[model samples]
Target: MTAELRGTWLYDAHVDLGTPIMVGPTPEGVRAIFPVTGGRLEGPRLKGRFLPHGGDWARIRGDGSIVLDVRALVEADDGALIHLTYGGRLVIPAEIQARVLDLANPDPLAGDRYYFRTLPLFETASPGHAWLNGICAVGVGRVVTGGVAYRVYAID
Candidate 1:
């Protein structure tokens, strides 16, 4: 038997981050830390905002791709707190990276020049949204002016 992959649009997360703190190049890659300031989360089933103090520990690989390890908290409108963790990769072409670096103001509209995606796992103690713990989720992201935006989907 074969299985078909299906997904449900879960939410759009607008996450703000502080400037990346460069950790310099390591044997694995060039490491950096991006502090999560705060942001909003909106969708049909889940609606809320991200709590501050979370962050992404990123590594720029030898080939210029980015590996992202992120952790955050989301507080639902009803006061339920959810733990969010995701790992993703950002593949940036050299030409596009050069263009972005050369520009005084990088255009977020040029997001098509690169690919950013993540596999997110959620954990919650709230009974109302407990179903989330059992399902797998994925998200597509883009770098915006002040932060990153992600459209998350639930694998069904």
Candidate 2:
């Protein structure tokens, strides 16, 4: 048996990251934390801004791919608060990473140049946007001028 995969646009979010706090080589790999300074969100199902209380705890693997461990809170335009967490992989060459991760660099790169994808999950107590609780989602990310923007889609 086979099941086809389908999806619907959920929201678009632009995440701003603060300076990274590098935790140098740990057993887990080269660790670092990119604070979630600010963000904005908008879409058909929901409209909101991401609270600046979370961050991305990324690790550089031996293969050079970075594991993205992100945590964030979303405040829907109506004031409903939702927790958004996602785990993913980002594969970028060291040279590019050095340039892009620098706060000094403001040039946006084309996402097709590297691999960046995320599996997002949402949780909330608000009745109006409760549909996000169980819906599996995927976010395709792009490197913006100073941050990363994602177009999230709900699996249907």
Candidate 3:
């Protein structure tokens, strides 16, 4: 049998970021640490703002792609604190990889220009929001002016 993705557009999390702390070259690749400043999370199932205490420690690959390792805390509107961590890949076109990492570019490329996909796993102790723990989500992300925004969906 073949598989299909009948997804429910669940929520969106617009994560803001501060300057990246460059870790220079490593055996694996170039490392950059991006701090989460503040952000807005809005959607039908999950709604809240991101707490300013998480970051992305991403390694830039040789082929213009990014291997993402991110962890963050989100506070739901109802006061529930959720912990989220995700590792994914972002494929950048070779033609624009340099400009994409140049921080000073001041412009975000259109979302359609690259492939930014993520699988996010969430955890929370709040009974009301425990459904997050049982769902597998697919996140389609884009680079925004000040941050990255993810439109998450649950596969049905």
Task: Say which candidate scores most in TM-score.
Answer: 2
Each prediction's Cα lDDT score? 0.87, 0.88, 0.88
In Å, residue 70's CA in model 3 sits off its true spot by 0.8
lDDT of 1 at 156: 95
lDDT of 2 by residue, 1-156 (tens): 889999999889898888889998988899999888888988998999878899999998888889999999988999999999999988887778766556547776678778899999999999999999989999999878657899999999
| Segments in model 2 whose C-alpha atoms lie over 4 Å from true places | none
Candidate 2 structure lDDT: 0.88
**Model 1: lDDT of residue 143:** 80
Better of 1 and 2 by TM-score: 2
Sliding window of 10 residues with minimal summed lDDT for model 3? 96-105
Q: How large is the C-alpha RMSD of every model relative to the true structure?
A: 2.0, 1.2, 1.6
- Model 3 residue 49 lDDT? 92
Which 10-residue span in candidate 2 carries the lowest summed lDDT?
Answer: 99-108
- Candidate 3 Cα deviation (angstroms), residue 36: 0.9
Q: Alpha-carbon error at 30 in model 3, in Å?
A: 0.9
| Pairs in steric clash, model 3 | none
